[model samples]
Target: MTWGVVAIAGVLGLATPLLVRPLLRRYGVADDPNERSSHRERTLRGGGVAPLLAIGVGYLLVLALGNTAAVGTVLLLAGAAVAAGLLGLAEDVRGLPVMVRASLQLVIGIGAAAGLCIAFGQQWWAAALGALLIAAYINIANFMDGLNGISGLHGLLSGMVYGALGAFSGSAWLTATGIVVAVAFASFLPWNLTRPGLFLGDVGSYVLGASLASLAVASAMSGISLVTALAPLAIYLADTLVTLARRAARGEPVLRPHRTHAYQRLTDTGLSHVQASLTVSVFSLGAAIVGVLIPLAGLNQWAGAAVIVAIAVVYLLLPRLRGSRLPRKPQTALVDIDRPAAIAPRVDFYPKRWIVLGASGFVGSAVADHLVAAGHDVVRLTAPRLALMPETAANPISVERALNSDDFDALVRAFEGSDVVINAAGRATPDSPADADLYGANALLPAFVARAASSAGVARAIHLSSAAVQGRRSTLDESLDTSPFSPYSHSKALGERLFLSFGSPDGETDHVVIRATSVQGPGRATTESFRHIARSFVASVAAPGNQPTVVSSIDGLVDFVTRVGGSSGPLGPIMLQPWEGHSAYDVLSAAGGSPRILPRWICTMVLVVVRGLGRVIPEVAGAGRRLELMWLGQDQRSEYTLEFPAMPNHVLVGILSNREDAS
Candidate 1:
């Protein structure tokens, strides 16, 4: 019978989103990318409607069965959940004042608590305690709904635990409500986790919080221990309270939308959304299991309380623990460079305010870290939005608007008083099918950034462009025209032209473009891919692989950037780092590959075939480009000089060393 109810609820849960999504789209109920948001793309909100509808229907069916005991309790819980969800839906659609929402929530909480006390014949004071608990959990769930799968997973897991407790304790109302809640939320997971993901908004969180809190209160009033009743929500409660306390201590507005939560911090420290969500869910599950076991095993409730406390403490400490393991200082010497140290001169570092766009990306992160290590006051901006600002900045700017937006006022404000603004953000993937995204990031973003910096009276704007802009060119120099072949390179080329041509009406900012070539280092997917290929059995190079591959060490690039930023006079519009003597063969050898030399003609033949296939297979063209690069590396004129030091061979060798350490 319980399985039947769950099956029906699951069907509704799965189907409701399909019905609701089009309406959401029609109404433009989308969550846009903002400085505080974890998501980069605009996504639909108010997806909580699906699970809310599912739960409501499932509970109605339970009432229709007519033979269930505790009918009043079932009705009360279902009514409370629906009311809370509706209130949240109202808030989501038409924004409500914070006080209005809080007042409404309190009213609902008190009504639900009093009703539950009447249904269970509990004391009046118990209603007060239950109301406070329900109201608190409601907000806690809402606050913790920042990550995908977090709220849904919490609802699913907690519902299952509550249902199990109901079954074990012979409470039919609890059993029916719990199963309905679990199945409904479990069905919402796919919609939340997949691409074009949907957020629950406040509606879903309200339903979940209301349902779970009511159940916990009911379970305790029905003779279950307090520790057991609240176990499922321990992690969420702890996270919200701790975060709020920390903010209050720092004199920050506690109610403001921010991303300082422990789960969010996990992402800042390099964990993907899925990994961080799972980390929290896994610990919550463990704590919930402990909660259930205490009563079943006839252990002291205090013992269970102690165990949950320990779990919550560990979960709270995760961000700090994970951060401590990350590489704080740059590992610049991971590879052994064969070049003379004399070629590279030491740079005298001067501290200045710096803004690194795309600070979450590979090159951007490296540049930001390098700047920070040199004692520069650095501000890191992730793509489409800015994150952390320098502590010294008097008025911190919040550029929460999308980069594609018409207004640049927010960005200009962010760039104010900064010495150098490094535009390191771009779509670097060569074969990505998202043409619009590629163009938006690679071509349009730089122009916008430059305009903003100029408006802000910034001294210098260093835009990082790819060497791939000089496509199919065997010999390259700063003076050569762009010959971009692919969409990626073409976008980069467009960006370069736009950036170099951009001038503020006031002429306050100077623009410099750095064409970085084949940058490789630790923490890069490309470096890892190279390492894997090098270790493969069939790794081979075309004969006479002595062509200078346009490889640049990240360390060397950072060094060059530092020098360019520190230079006093106008250096030039364009700069290219001299080739640090590493050929295709040398790169392979340094990566621990003993490649069998194949005939150059054979490699050419393969490239010809791939290029021919590229007519039907779009991705094959990218492979052809790779083959050509390996066969005939770009030769650049090294005479166009900057005052920066030449990179050492050890910087190149450090790539492999870092790979080994990672393994």
Candidate 2:
């Protein structure tokens, strides 16, 4: 009959979720995973309704069957559990202040304890102890609900202990209540363990805590040993106290929603949610055997205490040992351009499938190479097959095929399953310098990519912009408004605006614009890379002691790419600058040359003469303009500084010098 009641309760628990799941979805009561969340996808919340309903159904059903033994106690305790569950549901809908929430919990806990004391005819001291124990259990259980399957496993394990204690002590009320609590959570476990289906939320956790605490108190008041009541909960108590102490010692905000609990740390140390949950459940089971079953089997108090100490010792060392065994990845610093509060700092990122537009270009190729070398899956989206320049990888789709199709069919086809879509394809130096080409490649391409990325459910879409967008600033800062001095700068600025204005299809997709100063590196050679190359030549030939502007190294570009690309945090727009300022003359001087510093007027004259010569030399004017900008440090220095380790001024220049020497 007792097992039949448990089965009936389990059936109700299973049925409740099927009903509640649809309601939650219809009402949009879902949980969107954030930085502190373990799951990656949004899922239904408030699955606590399952267990809460099941317990209520079981209580009424048992009473209807004329099982009147301890019926009053069962009703009273179950009512308190329902009240606690409602309070948690209220919090889920609209957050309550900590003081209000905690005060309410105290009232419910103390009220249940007092009720148990009166029913069992216990003394005032017993009432006080019950209140304290119940309150502590409620809160500890609440704190322990950080991971998936943990709360359910805890509910199952602790329920079994209380149920067995009730059976042995011959309290029908305790036995029935324990069975209801266990069976309810057992029914909910399948939904939790299989996929990102449902979360217990605050409501479910609160009810679990209240139910378990009240059961413990009721049993103890009914002549069950206090040790037996506490033993099943020993693991939870220890973990909570230890974790709380650690957080307090570190001066962390105790009330904030953070993932720092021992079990959370276990997950961080490479244990899956299932593993962490099972580990805690296993400990709770061991504790029940030593503290409850062994005592029932006539073991002495000292033996139980010794076993508990062993459990505590194992709990203390488990995370540390497991963490040590796991290989640690190098931690990367996450930086936000302006909105620090909006961004989450992280050390590691899940490897993403990335699609690089303009895979043949300098910035595109460099970023694509880095993504591949770092083990991310990469797809190179290039020009049409007939217009295709040469391919290097397994996945290559032409730009015409990716972009020119109707209804974004081809774009969606190419972007499907990509986590990040990077639009690195832009023409900084067009052959014709036509407005149509400039606007099409720089502005329109980014806008199209942003739309496609959003439509395809990509998490992040990055569009590379040039520092030239804030052209000719005396002291360039990230906050500086765009000041396009030339056609190139104007187009780049327009491109940034287009990407930024291309709002997310859903609020979850993030768009980033990277405004980078001159990037000088190998791979796909560009005017910027050649300008730096020419600087080395100028350093080797020019009269010693002359200085020119600062340029960002290939290493600097790669560093910036890694930081921005790997971040699963908030992002908008950022500007990249040189690690430190150095003159082209300084670079040449460092490269074993005594380059004479030319007067500003002389340098201007040289540019004018080079431009005149470029009219005859065809591409000389464009090449000269690029060289002049490098010579003058592009007439801008970044207002915002990247927080990466600064490379020595001589290092980049020396690298350039070595390359120059090798050639």
Candidate 3:
């Protein structure tokens, strides 16, 4: 059954990667990241072996079971795909000359065309067209494999169209081949969706294109409409033809590798590899859908032509229009965080290109603005789920990894050709209370950044660490030994160690770690704070809250980064905070809330009650624990030595003022 054939192919497709990845790596089959490469690091190549192998095995099973009129044509299709895939594999392993490659492709295409003509009892004219189209499609598929997920999705969608057409035309061979190809690609998608995953490579692309071409050619031989047969591949065909024409007009080297394709252009402008690939795949699917439905609907020739033209026009224009609209100014306010008098100003230094990680986060966004405002070339790295605000979308760099994982290779790519790499990404809140989350972000992430910065030959790497690493010390300084008391603090301490260690080996990478305290800004406010104390305990809480102390503002943080960046000073760890700290209650009350104060005994009674409730309610436990810290704040108060200019007496008002101005 067709279902059984597809299911078998899908299982093989999924399993083949696991079997072949090690072999490819062992055989030294690797693709080095180049100027035109979508990936940042050198990764294993020859991933196509898996899917090609799957398709071959599936073809044999289908051939054995199916006794149909198109069996000889199906045999021709399988032979063509195998021949093309082998040629591609030869090119991948050992360099093949252009002439040799072309001669081989032509041989395979012509052979397939002759066989199809004989098997279908068709004329010489059909054979000539089939040969040309098959060869062309083979190359087009190879060209489109530059980005991740493009080839896989294209094969899947195109296969669907072919299967539908075959069913309509009552060709069992076409239907079986299409189903097998679609299922194989669907199974292989996960391995190609993210960075550090396998690519289809030349071999896989050749197999896909050849298989699809064979289906189309065979369909035409069966008296199916040529227009319907080619409709599924319209987007790919159009892009390939247009790119070829443009290159020829400019007299460029057409056979050489280049990044001028529309999809590549979209990536260059701001789209990620996945984003660009998906755009083309969706448009192609839409066109394929029309191809299948319009004939069934019996639309007139003129109307069908109009529909096809409209789809082509829209697909060609969408990327260009989207690229042109990316905003230069960042949506988040950077000026609000820049206080001229708060920290040292920028000294005389050359403006350097910078790469910023986690640009969608509160601190990262401000850092990006600071770099851009200073007229430095900044490439902001964003995750899949996070979109760059149009205000700051001037230019973007694609990092294919998600935010949570330790995708260090993406960092290396982003860090390439940059003078400085700023890591403004990390977990700031403890609401989730997962040790894995804290350790992954605060500890492991900085280590990854350090390695990437080193690998990219970056001049400097700055990491924004937290003062929480020191726990509740009264005399906070850089030299004081860290005694982290919580998961967040522990992770921060470990991260600081890892970052600082990067400079110890060979001293090539200048690493700077800033331990910042109580960073507050418009969006920097956290949900992880003191809660659930009785009204009677308010008085005791108010005393510690009102203690004079320094606070770190978002503006002060940015000023420190810029000034430190400008200086030619030696890289080392620094603790930064405002010179004066407003009492915790004074800062809290200033935010337009009625102050509550309670006696010490009442506070103790509330803590006991809250602790009891915390057994059943974890949230209550967190609240009760925070209240205990507030009660013990005076004992833990510290005079931090390294300081920036004081924000102001009315800190909350000044913060609001700064926020309003940025808006």
State TM-scores per candidate.
Answer: 0.51, 0.49, 0.49
Cα-lDDT of candidate 3: 0.68
- Candidate 1 lowest-lDDT run of ten: 330-339
Error of 2 at 416 (Å): 46
lDDT of 3 by residue, 1-663 (tens): 457778888899898888888887888887888876777877776777767877787777788886456568777888998898898888878869877998888888899998999988899999999999899899999988888889889888888788887778777777788877787787788888766788777888888888888888888787766677777788888887877666544433345576777777778778888888899898888777777765677656456556766787787777677763321211211111111111222335354788888888988899899889989899888622222222321111211132234356676777889887788888776433323455567666776787778888887778888776665566456543675544455556666765565433565666777766656667544411212122223524533345443344677667667655555533345444444455645544444334465565776787789766654444445456556545534222323334234445554445633435532
Would you list the rank order by lDDT, best first?
Answer: 1, 2, 3
| Ten residues in sequence with the least summed lDDT for candidate 2 | 386-395
| Ranking of models by TM-score | 1, 2, 3
Clashes of each: 11, 14, 20
Compute the lDDT for candidate 1. Answer: 0.78
- Tens digit of lDDT per residue, candidate 1, span 401-452? 3333644567788889898899999988887532346666776677678778
Using lDDT as the measure, name the better of candidate 1 and candidate 2: 1
Residue 336 CA displacement from its true place in model 3, Å = 53
Best by lDDT: 1
